[model samples]
Target: MSAEPLVADHAHEVSDHGHDPHATTTGLSHIKLAMWVFLGSECLLFGGLISTYLLYKTRGNGRTLPTDVFDIPFTSVSSFVLLMSSLTMVLALSAVSRGEAEAGRTWLLATALLGGVFVGGQVYEFTAFVREGVAFTTNPASSAFFTLTGFHGVHVSLGIVMLMSLFVASVKGKLTQRNAETVEIVGLYWHFVDIVWIFIFTVIYLIPAD
Candidate 1:
């Protein structure tokens, strides 16, 4: 028996209850599907970066590797903060799903704050690296290192912007249980960025540079 009618009935009921429904005949919503595709492409992009970094990190060609000046303890704390933001994102989605707009906004803001802290840490680390003479043009290793980590910092910064947007929407009374899917989509992106950082922190920071 086709379950299309059942899903259609459920969607109708949700709509009548003042929820968005965000219904589609297709199993997956178009936006969500597109996000998955974008993330897939992103994986390939990061893969190339990591491979390039690994290739050149061991071949500094007389220039000091950026990894040589890494502050592992500081970055470990930053990584922890970013990972915690993913948890806050989940809480935000859960709150929105349950129609707790105030709680949702609180978690959303918290997540954004965590992300901001991580980015701030990255900026400080980059400054310290430059002070230690690890300029991007100093060597191939430094170029690859900056390129990979800089791209990740950009992604995290964008995720913070998205979370702030959701928080603003809640404050403006435009976000409710009906908009849960929106929070979920943002959460998906935020979690992906955090997960990517785990791989980055492991390979770029934890691995021995020598």
Candidate 2:
């Protein structure tokens, strides 16, 4: 019944309902839940693409298949760069939550730059594959391969855009501690993209081609 306890309760209540514009009755942010649902749907989509690729991977019309043209070492480096971006994303969220605006923006920019590098690497890899006689229209296998990886690259590109948006917001002094949840939401998307790439890399690159 102390004034201090009452003040603490009021602060907590304000923190919940005041900061989040998308709060639900269950105290969860509806926006966050929606993001989770979206990601779940994306999983099914990627699953279908991966399954199709697997089915047609070796059916290359006796031409160059994905495995024949993969530059594993180069892709491995790109994958590492993308995974490192996830770490930078974590740092961004941490900095924003602590109200370190400058550090948060720095991390956000770093994450976006890393994503750009990954996407660039993917483009280079695709061009290299085409040079090696494996192209999107070269065979069913190539078509599926390009479709799957291309979708992922697009997702990464979108995530980079989101990160850069946050950076711009920070620069304009619009992003702050209250925007921490927004950063976390973007992090969810970026991490999801990165995780999907891991699966794609393991399936298409690491797995031995018989």
Candidate 3:
């Protein structure tokens, strides 16, 4: 019967519909769309690399062919490490969703460290290959192999940088529960890159050449 109570009840009803004037846009949707666009472009870039690899798979000289030089066990372990990083990435997103900022930051840092390990493995592998007479200019196979894997390594390094920045921002209170959606979007991109490696590893290391 009171005017003030009537207005308060109407205000509560509107708030339930999420019709607040101060409502912030959930940026996850835009971030996801941007990521998709980026990945689409990356597909073309990687498609070129893969085509080159196939074109050169059988053209190497007396140097180590893929089957000859691929250390399957070592690469398999590295592949698993990269895959586990994806799991850590998802855990980071989950932590942010649960408003556990510390846990989220921890997982993000773990993911970056794992990524660094993967990159280090790649560097060692490439160095060993070079020492074994697989110079980039020695043959098409060497060139293609180095080019494809090197490109992927660069991407992984960039991802690690982003993850570190995210973790630091979280530490400084720049990234907060309110930005959980942003964290989820970054995790989505990181996971996509990891999955792409599955196909890359299969083609580059597992499949037999004709």
**What lDDT would each prediction earn against the true structure?**
0.87, 0.89, 0.82
Candidate 1's residue-wise lDDT over 1-210, tens digit each? 324323442344434434444456564666677778899998998899999999988767897888789999999999999989999999999999999999999999999999999999999998899989898888999999999999999999999999999999999999989788889889999999998999999988997876
Clashing residue pairs, candidate 1? none
For the record, the alpha-carbon RMSD of candidate 2 to the native fold, in angstroms, is 5.4
Using TM-score as the measure, the top candidate is 2
For model 1, the local distance difference test gives 0.87
TM-score of 1: 0.88
Candidate 1's C-alpha runs over 4 A off are: 1-25
What clash count goes with each model? 0, 0, 0
* Candidates 2 and 3, the one with greater lDDT: 2
What is the per-residue lDDT of model 2 for residues 1-210, given as tens digits with 9 covering 90 to 100? 213312222233344325543334555665677889999999999999999999999998989888887898999999999999999999999999999999999999999999999999999999999988999999999999999999999999999999999999999999989879889999999999999988998988899978
**TM-score for each predicted model, relative to the true structure:** 0.88, 0.89, 0.84
Displacement of residue 192 (Cα, Å) in model 2 is 0.3
Q: Give the TM-score of candidate 3.
A: 0.84
